[model samples]
Target: MRQMAVIAPVAMVMVGGLSGCDAAQPTDSRFAPDYQGVETTLLDGDLVKFDVAMQGARGPVDVENYAECAAAQYALIRGYGFARHLRTNVYEEAGLWRGDAVYTISPALPRGVRTIDAEVVTASCVENGIPMV
Candidate 1:
């Protein structure tokens, strides 16, 4: 009975700790991204760039995924069915991690990071359970 009492408190503490984790996920594949906080820029031609704020407990991969989702959605909105991944800058500052991704949109998939099909890209986002712009 004494051992059970000690285990009960320990289990409660573990559950409480897990509940405090701040990781969040999209409700569905078609869910729009929380791009309200993301910054975007349009360079010369079809070059588009974005910087997304990494949420708590998110790492570089997560940031990359977020950027990719936004880029894909942006291209689709621009009437471009494809995009080429230019580059992504991942950095940390002030205890926050950020990802700056660049891509070029076109009617046909450009060279780089493989061909990006708008439909497949969006589907990939959905499969990955990431939000689109």
Candidate 2:
């Protein structure tokens, strides 16, 4: 009876594990991101605004990342070596996500904790398949 009890529990666990493996797994399309586009606006001399949109984003962080990628590329295009994040506003409606972000481009590192090296950030964005201006 002792051996039978142990074997039954072990068999039940094994069957449970195998059944779990047969359960439906999440598809790639569920998490795949779709980058819509980006719009750039020069707010002031070194201050710039990035309006970015995307679909199938996981959350606001994805939208913010899109804005960051745009800022990085814009800084590089303007011959700036660094950028400082000023502010960002993220919104989602239905399945579309939008980010309105502002950043400051400078030839040298800006005085802020949210600063980014344009060259480095741009390279990372490209590697991660993120779109930039």
Candidate 3:
């Protein structure tokens, strides 16, 4: 009885979490304009470049936002709270949108152009429907 009460909630939470998981690679076309994945490269100094691509009928703005989300998540993984956007090149080819974004990570907001709070950016990404990796 007591064991069932404890296990029931745990099981329910686990099932809910799994069924509601939104991070998986989506195969259905219903989620069009979907985020595919991200490629990251550590550059000289504290800069990291993220190349993000997506499939479907998305636009350049979507791809750029997805890349920025990747950068924000990466900054958080690296124990940083801010990312300074250096540059980004967005393009579309063969029905795919790809963006190459460069960012510098720092604990404090970088005194440069387009500095982003990683936590804020990540939250905004979730709200804007941009997938992060």
At residue 48, candidate 2 shows an lDDT of 98
Q: Give the per-residue lDDT digits (tens) of candidate 2, residues 25-127.
A: 6777656799999999998899999999999999999999899999999999999999999999999999999999999999999898999999999999999
Among all windows of 10 consecutive residues in model 2, the one with the lowest summed lDDT is 22-31
The sequence of per-residue lDDT tens digits that candidate 1 reaches over residues 1-133 is 9999999999999999999998897565442333324677999789999888754424577778778888888889899999888888887676566888988889986776655787787889889777767
In model 1, where do residues sit more than 4 Å from their true spots? 1-36
Regions of model 3 farther than 4 Å from truth: 1-31
Clashes of each: 0, 0, 0
Residue 30, candidate 1: how far off, in angstroms? Answer: 22
Error of 3 at 33 (Å): 1.2
User: By descending lDDT, how would the candidates be arranged?
Assistant: 2, 3, 1
Candidate topping lDDT? 2
For each candidate, give its TM-score against the true structure.
0.65, 0.81, 0.72
